[model samples]
Target: MSLLRILVRVALVALLSMAPLSVAAHEVQPAISDVELSEDTVTITLTTAIEPILAGVDLEGIEDTNDSPLSDRVDALRALPPETLAAELAERWPEIAERITLRAGDTRVTPVLVDVTIPEVGDTEIRRDSTLLLTAPLPDDGSPVTFGWDAELGGLIVRQGDDAQGYNAFLTSGAVTDPMPRTGVAEQNLGDVIVTYVVSGFDHIIPKGLDHILFVLGLFFYSLAWRPLLWQVSAFTVAHTATLALATLGIVQPTMWIVEALIAASIVWVGVENIWSGGRRDIGWGRIAVVFGFGLLHGLGFASVLSEFGLGQYFIASLISFNVGVEIGQLTVIAAAFLLLGLPFGSKPWYRRAVAIPGSLVIAAIASYWVLNRIGWAGDIPYLA
Candidate 1:
């Protein structure tokens, strides 16, 4: 066999081996904090996975704890019982506390730990969340306050007040929130909201959204012609956008695992169709319809992420901006693929045999495994769990 073929087989084997670990083994999600301001105190109740924090893993721009040098330490911390872990965090409180910033105008306020709530150790593979309740006394002059933490702690959603129009913002990279008002909802300018969420949506696609990237690639592999690719993408865009809106508005809600299973299945369907069709230049209307249907499933998946972090009072604006970012990311993927593959080798007679077919085979095989894993058919296999 030629070197290219040998290389392909090796790459496929590596992918298959790593497929199960991609499911959420040690993925780092953003931390969320609910800030409540009373006359004398500013209290923040933060909900986050405590293992990475306790293990001293730097979470900046990281998705998985395994990517850090301290991943084994993180896993070890995860095995500890709730009380044990809480006590460990208590021991580290002084160091952790200094990293948190609570400012009331020019005055720096220090917050004291009120409580720590860690869930009992369950499945070690699955993430377990812990809560921290910290409260600091307000300034005597009643100055508006702003909150931030070490960027190494990862992204944070700061929600002040309980109203729907309350001040809400996502802070990352050492960014702090706008000064929160002592009275009613603090107003966030429209332009800032747009920029924040657009970046968020784009980030989700370019680097963070691997599964979505593969699905888009599956769409691309179906045809090299612009018209066919455009039709399928347009259908997908419309369908996912609609469902993303519906789900965010709380109109359509499906069990999250079921949606995830169906999304993996969609990838399988698209990949299989590409291989069977053998790089057809024209797409059938039926193909467009199927793609649209799968897009709806994918939209629900998108909404699930948003729901976890929240959109706050700027729900409509954030939702629209995020979708726009996702579209930009999708187009970028297609453009990159075209420049690399379709532009260079698409006209060759062997392109279909050498590129599209084998690529689709890999996409299908990996997604097929995902389907089994997502639907619980794979059981608690040691590596997968």
Candidate 2:
């Protein structure tokens, strides 16, 4: 076989492997748990997609539960009646509780399953959330408590109720939060808050966010030349930062469906532009302006993710940290592109034809499909359906 054909075959296999990752990106939803500490009892209300967890699908680092080998079992569980599902969860509570830990001071507190609320069978296409209530008795002395799940359960959004300050955080993989009783203990300093949020933001872009990665790749392929790339990236960063702050502050509230559709459209636009521009160094101001506008849409998309873990006590810290992390992630993508493609072959005569054009075309095609899928035409495609 010709070298080009061999390379194409390998690329096709890689893309197919990444296809599940893309689907999983859109299905990313963290489980939320509301922890309320009362005088006598500690009540934890967790709202999560139960079927996947019950099916032994690892929620952490998984893009989509449907892509799991155990998806068939999850589907069967999803089809069960509410009562039956509740009963199954009841039977499974002991094992599940063992994986989740709650501690009052130095001593472990055992949580008893109080109630389970299962959603009625809805559109099987969408995973439905179920609520689980587990309670543990509070110590008479009223000491501080720490609670977290096993790393295997994935990330959990813990919201603190019954406190005036209302502290909340998105914890991942066995990471526990500061002590819960907010009165005596010191709150997280600004540095701690910043570090936590920064990691969250970077994770969203680097490994977890396939759509965002494609968008960044679209910008990267537009031009490897420093001047144009810097302008476009700076504009995008500034624009998204502005909108991310606004959306997080609740000033600009746009529906996610609209933001997501526009984000996909932005990817398609950039990819198509790269092809049309033909590796030109003279990218116009108009293109930069469009990029900035699309950056605003992308910011709203970022806001949707941040909304999952509401700005707790440290709103400014979290917002700024997350945006900084996103910028870092974006720069990392550009740097990787540079090292991989531009460093070696950017000056080559056939760089445009061999790399730029083909890459942009592929990005455009995938993003166009994403646009259609996000806008509800996914069911029309046989494989996607």
Candidate 3:
């Protein structure tokens, strides 16, 4: 057998071995909630995929819902009709509400289910989200209230209504927002908001962002040399920072569907260029320009995620902090790549043929699958979809 064929077979086998892990990673989406406090009641509208939760799966700590032992149950729940799923949640409200907590002063308040909205059954390949409304009665004394969810429910986006200046923050499991009043809750302090958003931004990149990880790896594989890699990454950072700010400020609004498709396309472009360039030592202005343009598309993608956590007061701080965190994440990736490949073998002649080309091929293949899958053509192909 030819050397290239052998390498291809080895890559395929490695991917197959990691298939279960990949599926699990892709299935988990963080739970997001919008909180509204009024004189009489505190309402939380949570949008999440309820199938795994209903299937007796413990989503806490698991990267993918499928990684749970309750995969069979999750599949069963997915097969259920929207009405049926809603009914099941209604019947299990007591159990479900226990995982979500709302408190007034020192007392834990039990929430009554206001409504449940589930998407109609569609292709099993697409995960459907259900909107849940839970309301808790406020204390007549007008005492401050705290809101949060169990660690098992994942992260929550806590936002306040009734305040002209809007209050919002992203909270991880077990983290509670500052005590909010029935009216006019103060915005979080600038330093605290900056720190909190920095953590949020870092969290999104290190573990949750597989696509972004692959894209960064594509850049690294282009050339492990410091000059070329730094140039590309710098251009990327500037471009993404621009779009992220613009999109968050609501000046440039684009549909997430388009942004996602473009993001995938960007990955393909980087990977293809790596192969075409053959790990050239010199960096070109054209490549830097391309990276900058792709960075804009990726910034839009980042904006989509940040949009879920409404930019409350301290908008500039939050925006800059998030951008700083993303840069940190990118640098971390580059550092790891250097440790693994560049440190020892970067100067070797075979490094380009053995590492850069093969890695780029794999990246290009995965990204091509993403492009097709994003456009809805892959259809139930486990890895591709």
Q: Using lDDT as the measure, which candidate wins?
A: 1
Model 2 backbone overlap count = 1
lDDT of model 2, residue 156: 89
Candidate 2 backbone collisions, by pair:
24-63
lDDT of 2 at 312: 73
True lDDT of residue 148, candidate 2: 89
Task: Give stretches of model 1 more than 4 Å off.
Answer: 1-21, 377-385
Model 2 agreement with the true structure over 252-328: per-residue lDDT tens digits: 99988878888888988998988987476767899899999999999999998888777677777788899989988
lDDT of 3 by residue, 46-101 (tens): 88889877787776677776567888778778888988888889999899788766
Q: What ranges in model 3 sit over 4 Å off?
A: 1-26, 162-164, 380-385
lDDT of each model, Cα atoms only? 0.82, 0.79, 0.77
Model 1 lDDT, full chain set? 0.82
Sum up the clashes in candidate 1: 0
Q: Give the TM-score of candidate 2.
A: 0.89
Q: Count the backbone clashes (under 3 Å) in each candidate.
A: 0, 1, 1
Worst 10 residues of 1 by lDDT: 12-21
